[model samples]
Target: MLVPSCENDGGDSKIDIQYGAVINIQKSSSSDTYINLVALQNGGDINLGFTIDKAVGDITSMDVVGLYIKSDGTTIFKGKFSTGIKTFPYTLNINKQKIYDAFTQLNSSDDFETGDQLTISAELTLKDGTVLKLINDDGSNNFSSNIASSSTYKVFQAYNVSCPSELGGTYEFTTTNVKAPTGESAPGPLTGTVTFEDQGGGIYNISDASFGGWTGLYGSGNIARNVQLKDICNKISYFGVDQYDEVFTFSNLVVNGNKISFHWENDYGEYGDTTLKRTDGSNWPALTL
Candidate 1:
């Protein structure tokens, strides 16, 4: 059990890392076609994002511009290769709502596969009339594949957010070569911005101050909520304990996050695994066209 912030006389426990508001645009199923927005921590970082699990990169190099994603409640373009944090000249934060909505409107007509490469190479003409070039170690190609993306969707980060500034705002999105997978290239490139509203509170504070505590966490911990995802669920277990290289079994399980929450058996016990409850109400929202 975690010590309550109120009971911490030693002042060792702080509170949940506070962060500015940030939005998350995510879908329900890997193949489901819908998305919804959620807020980042209250004075914390935006650590959630979307990933394109499988991509055919030979035809889709970094310079292939005209690709964007609508996850995390914002519209933004991620380069073919990135740190998932930096996309060259800009930082990855949820754009303001006004901009986000506009771009999403334009992209509403866009058709995409569930797991297509999100970025590609494009040409930028400089004031001097020189087209921006893609770089290569051998200087043979203008683009290269980035190491940051994986076959599975991973988190994109909106670093160090705060209260008022990160709230409702606009965002921008661009796309190019947005063609069906069976095609040679995408439907040209679409570059534009979108505007959106901060639909919900941008942050959630788990603090003892709200309840008079002195620790990093303040609320009652739900034993069932110990698991938040599949991996987290796999980590917990209870029964005739056995220490494998890395394994655990949990009892009375609960999962939390986004909208959906549930659990089952820990791969042990009799008719066992885990189960879910809708006590908190509402499952994660959907976003897809």
Candidate 2:
């Protein structure tokens, strides 16, 4: 818990200062097919943000600290703000190379694996050299508190993973043309079969996609697809090459059990929805295309 702002108790007035940090995970947008993760070995960059709420004194600089610990209480990585933060709601983009160095320093570990947890903490340095640390009831600044909202995050190696189990096998699909340009023929009820091949780690590849008579923007061919399951919002994403050999991506799909549906629009203002159902009980071998 953070100590509430208090001033003037014994006739001596002192400024109350509060600060904290938040780990921001990038959210997927309509244009984003997958969320990218900074590989531990290859090294990547991620943004770290901070919040400074109450401060009576002039805050000169704030130092943010982070540590990546393993299950054995070993500090695999330790990183800090190379310089003082000069502004509020400050965000720092940290490179994974620095993290790799920290890991090498600990046990000479060359690489990282999944399930690595990272704990971050922060402190404030006032202009007059007054240092205020994140305070907790236990006198530890490791965990998140009202003063500093620190947090631990689990590391994932891959990004843009699709649902492997439920998506595999063949599915019957029905597509209806919802909107089309003026003088364009509105598509009628279309039916087809789409075979999904599991590519491991929640990835699937779709081939032999036939949408009746309605030709897709990509010409009704094979498409690479993935999915991102958020807290409540889920999307079935598609990536393919068009007739012009240009790459395209479309998402905002809803999947319920054996049924999957999505709506898409191109730059030409053509749009429609395709609903899919798995009537055939077929589960292909994992990672076999």
Cα lDDT, model 1, residue 21: 14
lDDT per residue, candidate 2, 137-190, as tens digits? 232453333323223321111233122134556678787764445535446566
Question: What stretches of model 1 exceed 4 Å from their correct place?
Answer: 1-110, 113-117, 120-272, 283-289
Give residue 275's error in model 2 in angstroms: 0.9
Supply candidate 1's per-residue lDDT for 260.
20
Which pairs of residues collide in model 2? 162-202
| Backbone N/Cα/C clashes per model | 84, 1
How close is every model to the real structure, measured as TM-score?
0.19, 0.34
Put down candidate 1 lDDT per residue, 35-70, tens digits, no spaces: 111232222222212332212112111122223443
Q: How far is candidate 1 from the true structure (C-alpha RMSD, Å)?
A: 23.2
